[model samples]
Target: MEKTTNLQETVHSPKDEGGTTLGLSLDKAWAPKTEEKAETEAGNDSTGDAPEENHDYVTGYKLALLLASVTTFFFLQMLDMSIISTAIPQITSDFHSLPDIGWYSGAYQLTSATLQPLTGRFYTRVRAKWVFLFFFFIFEVGSLICAVSKSSVMFIIGRAVAGLGGSGLQNGGLTVIAGAVPLESRPFYMAFMMAFGQLGLIVGPLIGGVFTQYVTWRWCFYINLPLGGVAGLFLALLHAPDQIKKPQVSFSLLRKVIPQLDLLGFAIFAPCAVMFLLALQFGSSDYPWNSSTVIGLFVGAGVAFPIFLYWEHRQGAEAMIPLSMVRQRYVWVSSIQFASLTTSVFVGGQFFPIYFQSVKGVGPTLSGVYMLPGILSGLLFVLISGSLATKVGYLLPWALFAGAGTAVSAGLISTWGPDTSTAKWVGYQILYGVRGCGLQAGVITLQNVLPPAQGALGIAFLIFCQNISTAVFSVVGNTIFTQSLVKQITALAPSVSPAAALAAGGSAEAVRALAPPGSPELAGVIQAFANSFDTVCYLLIAAASLSFVASWGFGWIDVRKKPEPGKGDV
Candidate 1:
């Protein structure tokens, strides 16, 4: 076992306050040292986190600040994802383009999802800190665009831009932790970051509701600017080492970097994914399922899907999502489990507002309150699950619990009506949130299975599945909700035109004004909306159920067992 002597080169920058180096030439930073391997096999370090090894990872006061900055940035990014939900009705009112509601979230998710793989490559080949800062800048710009947009098209474009930046925030968060901490302690830190994100995810709508009511919808986006500024300031002050390092920043490195991003694979994939989702989005609503536009999209996606797979297969090591990594049982299983569980969260977040606003006749602000229990509980469990997994050294129990619990809760949510008690909805959401807590633990398990070099890519692949499926199924949920609303309303309340109600700025106020609350007409509409929500609930139920099925594939690996030095960090 040979050792690394001078593979690392440190350079002091002007920003170094107390001798913290801004650049580390970490070509083989983690390359196994003969002495370190021996110490590891001998179990000398009682606590896995504080090994008697020096990799020059960010430490001391700097470590605390770095972790806080990343976690706060993540919280802001997540807040962006759901905060827009409460503002959607107001946005459509301002833009007078009610039909464009889907495009707002859709565009963001699309850009974030499609560009995710490339972000992975970027992190792996370049400095994680630089990649993160660049993406953060993009996200802030996108948020600014959203805040000032005067038209629907501009707003959608802004969302797309924000998503482009959002693609890297989570991946970057995980990458930074990987660089800074040992594998044994990563789950707790990662979970700590995720717990804050969960808080953001759970509370986003409520915050959006406050902005839409007291301030304005634009403020929801404008709020990101300040939070981003704070995070950026901290990150700028502390330029820590990256996980996969290049010798130095140069134009020569840029030449090699472009090809590594797999531009050709992305070209083939982006359009195909858009086409497939558009088909799902437009089918039976914008156009007949048999219409040429819809059919062409489906056919195009079907053909291109296989072509992209083949291209990726041939690309092998250079592929956007390395097939070698994808072939691993744990990697694929973790991806599926994470995607399904997360998709359910996204779908439920969107649908709950509809139920609260339209069926129960609550305002947007109140709806967010109704949602707080679930989000808070989910946040609590995220922290608990991460901490407990570290202590117990096992994660499979949580995985199984996530699948079974969320499924049951979703099914219960589907049965709710306008008259359903507050206790029931609160109870159901708590169930869903606690059950879903175990999902984040899967990422830790995934990193344990892959090779050392592929860590960022593995994280990116998981994010891609999550973003793509959430984007796809959000549209699907929209379609299902809309079709059901139209069909059910037309039958139950013949006097009312569902189109007119939706187009009346798509707000609860609009629908409620069509008839008095106690009238049979209003009752019929609420019932119809309630039923439509059930279909959307079914989508989540199915997604959560799939998590259970994927849980079985995780095998029986003990997460406490550290990966070999040349392999992964457990």
Candidate 2:
């Protein structure tokens, strides 16, 4: 086998030029001594046929079609993740299930996180198109299951199934892009795909809100059927290529890959994640932080993590997450920033509704409507930053500004009280929209920094970190809000019992029934909700501050770098 030398090349555009020219050169490592090998490989007739040496293959149109196909998959996957937020209240009501409400979301997240890295590796060992097509079908089946689900348990099972498939879409799309395109072109293409993904995030909530209000919440899951089916059919028909390498499914290959699957790590990691999230969900509402359940969860996660780390190290190359990648400074810093950004976003998503409904006296419908500005702004920024990254070759500045803006927005929102003006609240939401631009843009940056060999795995890890952080922070934010609300209500309504006030806070009708007209207890309830909002906002501000520090570590990488001759594959 001839070995190709890998060399890095950089491209620079003249200030006067409107666009940068990235030149790629492919050179044969060794001149062919015979024509028979090339002829056989090319599937040309061998009867007096000569093999073409050093043929340059270009498929601009085919690449475009493949990208479009992958983008559709990406959109559907991300949309499902956030779409349920607006329909949560409705879904819970319809099923008459509250005990496992969180599981509807948490189950999907947990399964996805646990299976992500495995899917990434699976892509390397399987044909990209086949693997994607198989998983796409799985996802569609899951969606259909959810659409017809009559029970909460059935719905959760559907979500779990969907999550298993959704985990593949992100990594699978990237795998296809990596296989189809040259190394230097990836960032630009990645930005394009990310824009679509962000669009799904933006549209998901709005669509869910609309469906829940006007049509039916079931439509939210049903809608994915047509969109996903079209994308999958396109992939199966036009995008599937014969040129891509298929994995050798030998017993030896299975032995190597199966051990690398890290089933033990997943066993430890998944339960820890579930326990931690459960503890977060139940700690303040159902059990105290110091209670046996909460403490045991914390202790279990703490013990499992170090052991998991040691196991990863011991497994070395066979580990699901390689120790070397985890130890990289860029990886850790980027993961922290990504995780923190997600934490802020999730916290905001969870409580902003409460702020609108409880403190600002907006109805659920209106509150969902008010959230549109921030979501739309974030979508716009995702596109802007992605485009900008292609041109500017750096994302740190945008990350820094976004982090600072998020902190400022959170700080401003934290000051809200019963008397706060609606204009100020709307203004705060706009600031949040601006802040979201940075967070979404930062994802492309982190994905760009890792080596191409680890592209899928790296992307999965980034997402995993984000999900874990979001789950944990959501729990913490809830705890903070509940504690602050309780404290404030108790202090203000010394005459009214804490238990009575809590009972009132549980439902709007209960609160109205318990409090007499213009009573001190009613006033106390209002004050308590406001104080809780303020506390959660302050915590978000702190998270944003940490995001700023993490942004600094996003080392600059020039996306315009010229492709070295004969070094097309990364």
Q: How high is the CA lDDT of each candidate model?
A: 0.78, 0.65
Question: Evaluated with TM-score, which candidate comes out highest?
Answer: 1
**Which 10-residue window of candidate 1 scores lowest in summed lDDT?**
5-14
lDDT for model 1 comes to 0.78
Tens-digit per-residue lDDT, 1-570, candidate 2: 441222112222233254533221112211242222222322222353432221122367877788899899998887886677666656755665433445666667666666766675565445567778778888888898998898888998898788777767776776676666554555667767876777776777778777877888788899999998888888876644322334444566566556546788777767766666667777756788789998998888788888888887776644677665566555677778877876777677766755665655554456667677777776676667767766776666777877888888889988988898878877887787655555544445434444334445566677777666665665567667667766887787666655555444322333444456589777777777778778988878988888888887765545554444566654
Tens digits of lDDT, candidate 1, 165-221: 999988888888877876667888898899987778777889998998789989999
Candidate 2 has which clashing residue pairs, if any? none
* Runs in model 1 lying further than 4 Å from the true structure: 1-54, 96-99, 561-570
Residue 139 of candidate 2: its Cα lDDT?
A: 86
Clashes of each: 0, 0
Q: Model 1 misses residue 438 by how many Å?
A: 2.2
Q: Model 1 misses residue 532 by how many Å?
A: 0.9
The CA root-mean-square deviation of candidate 2, after full C-alpha superposition on the true structure, stands at 7.9
